[model samples]
Each structure stands twice: as structure tokens, then as C-alpha cells.
Target chain A: MLKTRIIPCLDVIKNKVVKGVNFKNIKVMGNAVEMARYYSLSGADELCMLDINASYQNRKTFIKTVEAIAKVINIPLTVGGGISVLDDITDLLNAGADKVSINSAAVKNPKLIRQASIKHGSQCIVVAIDGKRHENKMKVVVKGGREITKKELIVWAKEVQSLGAGEILMTSMDTDGVQNGFDSSMLKKVTSNVSIPVIASGGVGNLEHFYLGHLTKSTGLLAASVFHSGKYKIKSVKKYLKNKGVPVRL
Target chain B: MKKKVIGLIDGQSGNIGSINKAIKEIIKGRPYQLKIIKGEFDNSLFSKIILPGQGAYATLISNLKKLKIYKPLKKYLDNNRSYLGICVGMQILSDQGHEDKTTKGLGIIAGEIKKFKSKKLIIPHMGWNSIRLNKEDPIITNNLDNKDFYFVHSYIFQNIKKSNVLANTHYGKKFPSIIKKGNIYGVQFHPEKSHKYGLNLIKNYILKS
Candidate 1:
């Protein structure tokens, strides 16, 4: 049987990790490579680096950060944020990233997903969906959850699968930064509908929240604040899940 | 005497960062030099060869051809020199691969790469899964028994001979996780990314063999 993966999602800006409350009120943790090295050596099965820097100069810094982290870390690294075209994906993969995540670009032009998966295998293409609750339905939101779309979350998840996405990184904008827990019901809906692995992101406050995240049928549990702020250690989370019979690597 | 160098072929196919780092870490105090083979490689300079790959099968072979190592690689395999193939490098050792389209492989072994067909499981079998060793090979299964190795792939070599399989792991059905024919070795899992269990395997390959 496959073990559950614990991933720490680092919001990187100018080669530094930044954690925000409800996607705002940003605070810097430390250097990106140092933080990533700590998590990888601890118990993180994989690490996700998202470039939150909006400026062009900062994006170059993010790529260099990825290269530096890859040199020290011996695990799979997934790089996301501002990946609009195939060349962007190529640049990251060439820089030692195992996978490149596409969010708004995949929604804006579905062909990019097809082109990326075709050029580089689908195993390296992860489609990230940022969704928010709207009137009893999970609506797909882009632009870092600032804008909502007519496309529903479940529908877009299935569409990405058809367009050749290896995995889906689903984040609940409503629960993000609140640190209560994952949106289990929404996660269950998407995980049950799609065949690809689903990584549940956004909310995780305690060890029990990670347990709940795995219980919802997600292959991975990704959190930002709990991991960044040093409240919950990755080893404890893996040990907790192993005790709960969740099949985690301890 | 010159140092016994291990040739690592990087055909500009995909990322070989972790693999390169792992090899460097393993050969720190050893009696071997790690050489990254980019363009043309003189086959006789190295005692062992390793091909680590990612991405599509067509792109990998195309890059190998573009680098003009296709013929030399085929010669290396034919001579039964110590060789190891990781991930897509393993898949390309068969007769053909059915990814995106049917791409011709090196034909160093007797098999065809087929996609894993399981209505129960996902396409790309990604994550850490335990392997059941069928038989013991010193380089491939040294100090490894019923241990999990990291895997991330969609297709696997189908209908391989029983003697060629060193280990197999189950997704929906059992597929070859490690395969060996003569001096040639192929592993479906990434030993570099798989922590201790994987590092031990690579160390055994370099030090023991």
C-alpha cells in the first residue's frame, strides 16, 4: 500500500518564505532554502514552493531559490506560481523541479495543460485549483482567490484530469489561513470523482487536522501556517497518522 | 593507474539533479570519479554507466540521438558492461514504449512498455510503495527486503521474462520494480529520491559491483 504524503507549502517571495492570514497580512519566516531544508530533513515527503512575488525581478530570485533547494534536498520538489506557458514549466523542471503546478493558466487556456503534459509527461504536471464556498457550492476562484468563476470546483477538477493532469492540488480559499481544518466534504467530492491523486491544501492547525485531511481520501496533506510558524512538527504528524492506522512513513 | 570513473549520461532529457547529488554523496571517500556524460562519450573511459531520466520516452531517445550517444549506449549494453537505468531510463531499455505514441526503445531486453491498466488505481503510481523481492541480486537488493521505495510513473514493462525481474511491486497488479539482465540493471523507482533504502541500493551498485 502507498503511504500518505505530508507536504509543506511554502509561499516564497524574493527567496524568502512568507505566511499570510487569509492570504494577506504577510509575514516573513526566514530564508526559503533554509526553511525548505529543515522540512525535507524532518519528515516532509515532498515540498511545494509557490512564488508569491509579483515583480519580474523577484521571479528570477525564486528560480534561483529552487535550484539552491534542489541541491541540498533529495526529495521531490514541486514549483508553482505564475507558470503560464510550457516554457515556464520547462524552466522549472530544468532547474531541478520534479513537477510544475499550473493554476490560472490551465483555467484560462486549457490547451496549456494539454501542451505541457504532452511535451513533458503528465506525471510532472500538477493542476492546482483554488476554490471558495459560494452559496452552498464550491466555486473555482483564480488570481489567488480574489476572483470567482462560473466553473465549479468538481467540474474543473475532472476537466483537468481529462486534459492530462497527473495530480490536483485543491485548496479551500474559505478555510485557508483560518487554520481550522481542511474542507473534508469538498475534498471528498473531488477525490471520489477523480482518479488522480488529490493533495488537500489550505487549512491545518493541529495533528488531528492532518488526520482528518488523510481521512478525506487525499493522498497528501499540505499546510502553510502550522508548518511555517513551527507549531506542529512534521515528525509528530507522521507519527500521529501512523498511530491512527493511516499508513504514513515514520 | 587512472581512477575508475562512473559515467552518468545526461542527454538533456530531463532533471538529473537529485541523482547527481546522490552519486556525489555516495562516492565521497570511494575510489571512483563521477563523470556527467553530456555530448559524446568514449565508452572505454568508464567502468560503469548510469542513465537517469524523467519525462516522455520519445523525448528521451530523441535527446540521446541528438547527443550522439545512442550508438555508444547500445554498444555499452551489448558488451554487458555494468549499467543501471532509473525511471524512464529503465522503460527505454525494452523494445518499445507506448507513451503519447509508440516509441522505439533500445531493445537491450525482451519486453514492451505498456501503461498500467487498473480501474481501481490512479494512472501515475506516485508515492512510497513497498516492493516484494522475487530473488536476491547483490547490487539491486542488498540489505533491502520488504522495504518501500519512492515511485512516480504511469507505464511499466509488461511480459518481461521471469528471470529478468529482480523485484516487483503491486499497484493493481504486480509490475517489475527492478529488472536485471546480465550486467544491465534497471529500476522503476528513483533510488536518489527514496531516502535511506534507495541510497543503500545505489551505494551497493557503486561499491560492491
Candidate 2:
């Protein structure tokens, strides 16, 4: 039986791991390699290394960061940020990344998702959508959650799924650093619209939020601030989920 | 006694570092000399070869052709030198791949690699999956005992010979997890990433060969 995944997002800047508040005000955490090793041993199902400085850097630092982390951790790693082309996806996959995630790039060029899914397997491509509620509707944001796209969250999710994105990682920018809880309303809307696996991201402060996220039909749960700041260890979270009758791997 | 040189093929399609680590862990403190070979692989120096990959099947096959090692690999296999394929490397042993529809594979194994069609199961069957041994094959039987092995593959081999199947796993349906026919063997899961059982499998492979 397939179990729900517990992913920890690591923001990388200039080859160092950092955690920020609401995707800004970055604070250094530790070496990328060291942090990756710790996460692997600490029972993280998967690791996502988001190159937060991708838009600023001409060349994406995700591949180098993935290569550095791949040396230590043997689990699956997903790389995102500034992944615009099939070549970018190819480079990351070749650099030991199991999956390549596209946020702003996929929103700009929808065909890149199809092209990448065709060239590499759909499982290799992950479509990440940053969402924020606007005008009583969840709106999709791009470019590190700065630019809002003129697309509805549910509509874009269905489009990406049709474009061969095997999974969707939807993050709520509004609830990201607040940790009030996951955007259950947004997650419910988008997951109901797409048939592919939906990974709920942002605002995971406590074990109860994780439970609520799973109840919203999310196949996976991702967190950065909560896990990085030592609010709860991943192993303890998994144990709690198991105790709560959630179908989590212990 | 001549040391068995295991050729680690590196065609730049995927990282071979973890595979090398598995090999080192398998050999342990023993004085067995294992050599890592790159570029157009010359199989003359090694008794057995290990092909490991992590990317698209077409890219790996294309790169193998570009390096002009595809024919040599086939020739080595024809001569019955032991060959082991891991992950995408295992998928490329088939006749064709669905990822890139028109791309041809090494055809070492008589099967086609197709995307696992399941609305319920994830495309890539990631994480630890238990392998049920079909028969008492020495490679896995000596090490693993119905334990979970880590798997991360989008495409799985279809229409493979039952005689070659050493073990099977149930994702949506029971599929071949480990296939072995004579000196050629392929594991759909990554034994290197599977912890104790995986390393034990690798140890068994190194010791038996």
C-alpha cells in the first residue's frame, strides 16, 4: 500500500541551506549537505530543495545543490525554482534529483510541462503552484510568490494535470509563515479538481494541521518553518499521524 | 586467484556515486580490487559489469550509443559475462520505453517498459516496497527475507519471461521486482538505498560472483 509522504522543504541560497519568513528575511540554517543528511536520517520521506535565489541567478543553483545533497542522502530529492525548460529538467534529473518541480516556469509556458513529461516520465516532473486567496477566490502566484498569475488555482491545477504533471504541490502564500494551519479550503478546491496526487504545503504548525491537511485529500504534506525551526521532529509527526489513525508510514 | 573486476559503467546519463558506495559497502574491508570505469566501456578487463541509472530511459540508451558502448555491452552479455542493471538501467534492458515512444532500448531482455497505469497508485512507486520471493534464487535469497526494498520507478517491464523473475511486488498488481536469467539480473528497486536488506543483497551479489 502506498503511504502518504512527509517532505521537508529546504531553501538554498548560494549553496547554503536557509529558512525564511514568508519567503523573505532569510536566516542561515546549516550546510546544505549536512542538513540533507540530518533530514534523511530523521525519517523524512522526501526532501525538496527550493533554490530561492533562482530568479536572481542567471543559472539555477538547484543542480549543484542537488548534487551536493545527493552525495549524503540516498532518498528521493525534488528540485524546484527557475526550472523553465526541458534542458533544466534534464540537468536536474541528471544531477541526481529524482523529480524536477516547476512553479513560475510552468505557469508561463504550460507546454514545458507537457514537453518535460514526454521527454522524461511524468513522475519526473512536479508542477508546484503557489496560491493566495484574492477576490474570494484562490489565485495562483508565480516568481517566488511575488507575481500573481491571471489564472484560478483549480483551473491551473487541472490544466497541469492534463499537461502530464504527475503530481501537484500547492502552497498557500498567505498562510505560509503564519502557521495558522494549512489552507484547507484552497487544498479542498484544488485536490477535488485534479486526479493526480496533491501535496499540501504551507502553514503546517502542529500535528493537527497535518491531520487536517490529510483530511483535505492531500497525498502528501510539506513544511519548512515548522520543521526547520524545531516545532516538531518529522519522526514524532509520523508517530502522531499513525496514532491519529492517519495512513502514515511509521 | 584472479580478482573479479566489476566494471561500473559511467556514461554521464546518471550519477554512479551511490552505486560505487554500494559496491564499497558490499566488498567491505576485504582486499577485493574493484575498478570504476567511465567513457566507452571496455569489458575486456572486468569479469562482470554493473550498469546503474536514475534518469530517462531514452537519454541513457542514447548516451550509451553516443559513447559507442552499446554494442560492447551486448557483446559482453552474449559471452555470458554477468551484467546487473539497476533502476532506469533495468528499464533500458527492455525492448522499448513509453516515456519516449519511438526510442529503442538495449533489448537484452524480451519485454517493453510501460508506464504503470493506475489512477490510485502514484506514477513513480517511491519509498520502501516489500518484495515477495517467487523462487529461491541465490542472489536475493542469501540476503533478503521478504523485506521491504526501496523503489522509485515510473516505468516497469511488461511481458517479461516468467523464468527470469526472481521476485515480484504488488503496487496495483503484482509486478516483477527482481528478474534473473543465468548471468544477467536486473532489480527494479534500488538496493543501495534500501538500507540493511539492500546492502545485504549487494553483498550477496559480490560474494556469489
Candidate 3:
């Protein structure tokens, strides 16, 4: 059986790992390659690096960072953050990323998901949805959570899956970087709405939230702050989840 | 000693960086040489062949055919020299694949790839999963027996011959994860991305197999 994946996400900006609250106030974490290597060796099932700022100058550095990380680590790498075109996806993959998650681009051009999946295969095209509860309904937000689209969370998620996306990376904006817990309710809703594997991102504080990650519909649980802050090692998290009857790779 | 040349078949559709980097790292200071076989490659030039692909079955087959390496690849593996396939690379070893439309595979291991039938689990069985060994090899030393490997695919080798089955991973059903017929070894998981155990498997194949 497939085990639940404990992924440590690193937000990248100018080729450095960073953290932000609600996708703002970015703070550098560390060297991208070093942290990525550490995470891979530390038993991270997969590593996600979002190029939080994918500018013209940052693109080269981001790709360079990806190449360096790929050279050092043997596990899978998923690179996101400001991926807007087919060429960008090509460059990232060519630079050694295993998968590329698209958010704003995918929302703006849903056909890009189909085209990308057709070109690179569905397995490599991960559609990342940033959901925020506006009023009473969860709506999709894009552009680093700066703009909220009219698309409802679940409907847009199902659309992407039908558009040939292999997986979904659901990040709740409200709870993101809060260190409270993963938005399990929203995660469960998204996971239930889609047939493809969903990765629960945004909020994860402790072991309970990690265990709750397994209980929810998500197959991959992503925690940024805990792993970035050095409060919890990925190995310990997996062990904890495994002890709690979650199928994890140890 | 003769130079052991390993050819990584690049059909222009699949990602080969991680695989390329992994093999390069393992074969450092060794007698092995890695070659990226893009278009037409002389099959005899390679002591071993590694084909790593992704995407739809039809697209992968089309890419292989477009590069004009499909026939030569099939011919090369028909007699079974040391070979390794990952994901779509493994799927293409089958006689046919039923993803999207019925398409032809290498017909090497005598099987057909089909999507998972059970709705209880996710379609693409992504993430790490442990395998159950069905057989062992004395010549080609791969310690893949019951070891966890990373897998991401919706299709499984369902109609595979029993003799060809080497390892099976249970998701909703007992599907063949590793299939070997003679010297050809095809794993549904990405050994290059499967961490330490996976790298060890590649190292074993390169040094021993």
C-alpha cells in the first residue's frame, strides 16, 4: 500500500528558503541546496520548493538552485511559485525538478494544465490551490494569495483534475503559517471532491496535526514552519505518524 | 576490463535529470559510463539500458516512435541485455497499454498495462510503497525484495505472465511492481528517487547485474 508522505516545503525567494505569513513578510530560512539536502537525508518523503518570487532574474537562480538540490538529493523534488508558462515548466524540469506545481498560471489558463499534462504527463503537473474562506464559502486565491479568484475551491479543484492534473496541493490561506494546525476540514472537503491525491498544506503545528493529516483525505501532508523552525525533524514526524497507525515510510 | 557503457534512453517526453544525476553520482570513480541516448542509438554500444519515461501511454509510445528508437529498443531488449525501466519506462515493456487508448508496448515481458480497477484508493498510486518479492536473482543482484520504493502511476501490469513477475506491491490489489524476463528488469517505482534503498538497487544493477 502507498504510505502517507511527509513533505517539508521550503518557500524560495531569490534562491533562498524563506517563510511568510499569509504569503507576505518573507523571511529567509537558509541556503536552498543545503536545507533541501538536509531534508532528503532526514527522511523527508518528498521535498517541495516554491519559487515564491519567480522573476526574470530569480528564474535563473531558482533553476540553478533546483539543479544544485537535485545533485545533492536523491528524493523527488517539486518546484512551484510563479510558474506561468510552458517554457518555465520545461526549464524547471530540465533543471532537475521531478514535478512543477502551478497556481496562478493554472487558474488564469486552465488549458495550461491540460497542455502541460499532455506535454509532460499528468503525474508531473501538480495544480496548487490556495483557498481562503471569504464570507462563508471557500474561494480560490492565486498570485501568492494576494488575489482571490471567483472560482470556488472544490469546483476549481475538480476542474483541474478533469483537466488532467495528477495531484492537488491545497493550501489554506487563513491558517497558513499560523502554526495552529492543518486546515483538516477544508483539506478533507477538497480531498473528498477530487479523485487524485491531495496534499494538505498551510497549517501544521504538532504531531497531532500531522496525525490528523493521515486521518483526512490528503495522502501527502506538508508542514513548513515546524520543519523550517527546527522544532520537529521529518524522521520524528514520520515515526510519530507511523506509531499512530498511519502508513509511513521509515 | 571492458568499459561498461550505460545508455539512458531519452524519448524527449520524460524527465531524466534526477535519474541522470543519481546514476552519475553512483558511478563516480567507477568503470561505468552514462550516455543519454536521445535520437537513434546503436543498441550494441550499451552494456546496459535505462529507459525512464512519464505521461500517457500513447504519448510515450509516440515519442519513442518519433525518435525512431522504438524498433531498435524493442530489438535490443528482445534478447534481454541488462535493462532498467521506471514508471512509463516499465509500462512500455508490456505487450500493450490500455491508458487512454490501446497502444503497443515493447512486448518484452508478456503483459498489458491497465488502470487500477478499484475505486477505494486513489487512481495514481503515488508515494512510497513496499514490495513483496516473488523471486530472486543470483546474477543480477537487486535487493528490492520487500523494500519500499517510490511509485506514481495509475496503471499496473495486470495481464503480466506469472514468470515475468518479480515483485508485487499491494494497493487495492496485488499488482506487479517489478517484472523481469531474462536480463530485463523493469520496476514501476523510480529507483533513482527512492532514497537510499533505491540508490542501492541501481548500484547493485550497475556493479553486479
Candidate 4:
């Protein structure tokens, strides 16, 4: 049986790991490589680094951060944010990122997903969708959940899969930063529609919430605030899932 | 005493940074240097070799041939001087690959690479899964029993000899996760990306003096 993965998402900005990662083991605190190493040792099945850095000059710096992290840790790294073109994906992969997640750019131009999948096998291409419930209908939103699109979550998910995306990163803006739980309903809708793996993100507050995400169709559970705030440890969540009869790599 | 150099073959199939990191971490204090084998490499230069590859089966095999390392790799494995293959690196060791079209492989093992069938099961059997040891091998799996390792592949070795398989993992049915024939070893999972358990496997391979 495939084990449920516990992923800790780190928000990377200009080579520093910012946004709510408060842990004692963070030796360098803001250092991306140190945080990545700490997460790998903390039993994180995988690490997702969203490069929030937006500058042409800082591109090399972000790649260097990826190189440093790849040198220290032995876990798969999924990088997202600012991936607009095929060259961006190629650059990140060359920098040692195991997988690259494409969000807004994918929605703006679905051809990028197909082109990327062809260039670098679909297994490394992740389509991240930010969905928010509006008028009792879940609509796909982009620009970090600031803008809403007319596309339905399920419809867009199926399209991405057809375009050759290997996995989907479904994040709920409404549940995000709330510390309640993941949008299990939305995740179920997307996962059911697509055969590829779905990673449930946003609003993972406690151990039970992590378990709840497992109960859904998602294969991986991703949370930032809960992990960065030190409210729960990665190992503890893995332990909880393991005890709850959810297959987890301990 | 001269330090042993471990050759990590890079066929330009994909990134090999993680594998390098794992080996470096394992052999920190030891008198061993990790050498990157980008193109044609002499078999006698290194004591052992680690082949890590990704992407399509035909592409990787063709890349090896294009780099003019095909003959050398075959000769090196024929000598049985401790070689480890990860993912497509392992798949290419078979007789042929059935991905897209039937492509010729190294024939190190008498088998064909196949994609997982079954409408119920996912195409690329991704994520962490546990392995059941078929037999004990100190270098292949070491003492790591009943532990799950990260797997991300669409195809697996089929019609393989029973004696050649070292461990089996199940997705829809039991498939070879680890295979060992004398000094030749191949793992379907990426030890470089498997975190601690993966690091352990790499350590076992490097420190198995």
C-alpha cells in the first residue's frame, strides 16, 4: 500500500525561508538550506518550497538555494511559484529540484503544461490550483487567491491532467490561514475527477486535520502555518497518521 | 593506501545532485571521493559505480549510447564490480523496454520493462510504499526491513527470474522493488530521494568495503 505523505511547505523569498516557520531546529532560521535539512530530518516525506521571490536578478540566488538544499537533504523537493515558462522549469530541475509546480501560468496558458510534460516527463510536472468556494460553487483562483477565474475547479483539474500533469496541488483559499482543516470536499471532487495524485493544501491545523486529509482522496497533505508556527511537528503528524491506521512512512 | 573513487554515471537523463549528496554524506570521513562520470569513463578507474537516471527508457538508453559509454557500461557490469541502478538506470539493465515501443536494453537481466496495467490502479505508481525482502543482501537493502521507500515510476520489470529478485513491493500486484544478481544491483525506487531510509541504502552501498 502507498503511504500517506506529510509535507511541510516553506515559503521562500529572495533565498530566505520566510512566512511562519518557527522551530528551534531551524539553526539558521532564515536559511533555506538549513530549513530544508531540518525538515528532511524531521520525517517530512517531502518538502514543497514556494519561491515567492519575484525578480530577474534573484533568479540565480533561488537556484543556488535549491542547489544548497539538494546538497544537504535526501528528500524530494517540489518547487512552485513564478514558474511561467518551460525554461523556468528546466532551470529549477537543473538546480536540483525533483519536481516543479506550475500555477497561474498554467491557467493563463495551458500549453505550458503540455510543453513542460513533453520536455521533462509528466512525473516532474505538478499543476497547483488555488480554489475558493464562491456562491456554493468552487471556482479556480490565481494570483495567490486574489483573483478569481470563471473556471470550475473540477473542470480545470481534468483539463490539466489531460494536458499531461502528473499531479495536482489543490489549495483552498477559504480554508487557508484559518487553522481549521483542508477543503476535503474540494479535494475529493478534484481527486475523483482525475486519476493522478492530488496534494491537499491549506488549513491544516492539528493532527486530526492531517488525518482528515488522509481520509480524503488526496495522497499527500501539505500545511505551512501549522508546521511553521510549531503547533505540530512533522514526526508527530506522521505518528498520528500511523496510529490512526493510515499507512505512513515512520 | 590510495582512496577509492566511486563513479556516479550521469547520462544527462536528469538531475543527479541528490545521489551525489547522499553518497557524500555517507562517506564523509572515509577516504573515498565521488567522481562524476559525464561521458565515456574507463571501467578500471573506479572501484564501484552508481548509475542514477530518470525520464523515458529509450531516451536514457540512447543517451548512454550517444555518449559512447554503452560498451564500457556493459563491460563494467559484466565484470560484476558492484554496480547499483536507480529507476530508469535499473530499467535499462533489462533485456528490453516496452515503453512506447520495444527498445533494446543492456540485457544484464533477462526481463522486459512493463507499465502497470489495471484501470483501478494509477499509471505512475507514485509515493512511498513498503517492501518485503525476498532474501538478504548486505549491500542492496542492508538491514532495512519492513520500511517504505519513495517510488515514482510507470513501468516495472516483468518476466524476471525469481532468484534475481531481492525484494518485492505491491501496488496492484507484487513487483520487484530490489533486484540483485551477484555484484549487480538495481532498485526501482530512488534511494537518493527516499530521505533517511534512502540515505541508509546509499551508505550501505558506499561503505560496503
Best by TM-score: 3
Tens digits of per-residue lDDT for model 2, A6-75: 8999988867888777667778987778888988888887889887787546345556667878777866
List-wise, what DockQ does each model earn? 0.70, 0.31, 0.86, 0.70
Chain B TM, every candidate: 0.96, 0.93, 0.94, 0.97
Residue A98 of model 2, lDDT score: 74
Question: Runs in model 1 with CA error above 4 Å?
Answer: B140-142
Models sorted by DockQ, best on top: 3, 1, 4, 2
Docking class of 4: medium
lDDT of 1 by residue, B6-125 (tens): 999997756788889999999998788999998777898889999988777888998899999898899889898999999989989999988768999999889999888978787678
Score candidate 3 by lDDT: 0.87
**Among these predicted structures, which one has the highest lDDT?**
1
Q: Which lDDT tens digits does candidate 3 get at residues A169-225?
A: 999988888888988889989988889999999889999998887788799999888
Poorly placed runs, candidate 3 (over 4 Å): B138-143
Residue pairs that clash (backbone atoms under 3 angstroms), model 4: none
* Ten residues in sequence with the least summed lDDT for candidate 1 chain A: A52-61
lDDT of candidate 4 vs native?
0.86
Report the poorest 10 consecutive residues by lDDT, candidate 4 chain A.
A20-29
DockQ of 1: 0.70
Superposed model 4: Cα runs more than 4 Å off: A20-30, B140-142
Local lDDT at A75 for model 1: 77
Please report how far candidate 1 places residue A2 from its true position, in Å.
Answer: 1.0
Backbone clashes for every candidate come to 0, 0, 0, 0
Error of 4 at B175 (Å): 0.6
Tens digits of per-residue lDDT for model 4, B136-162:
777644557778899999899999999
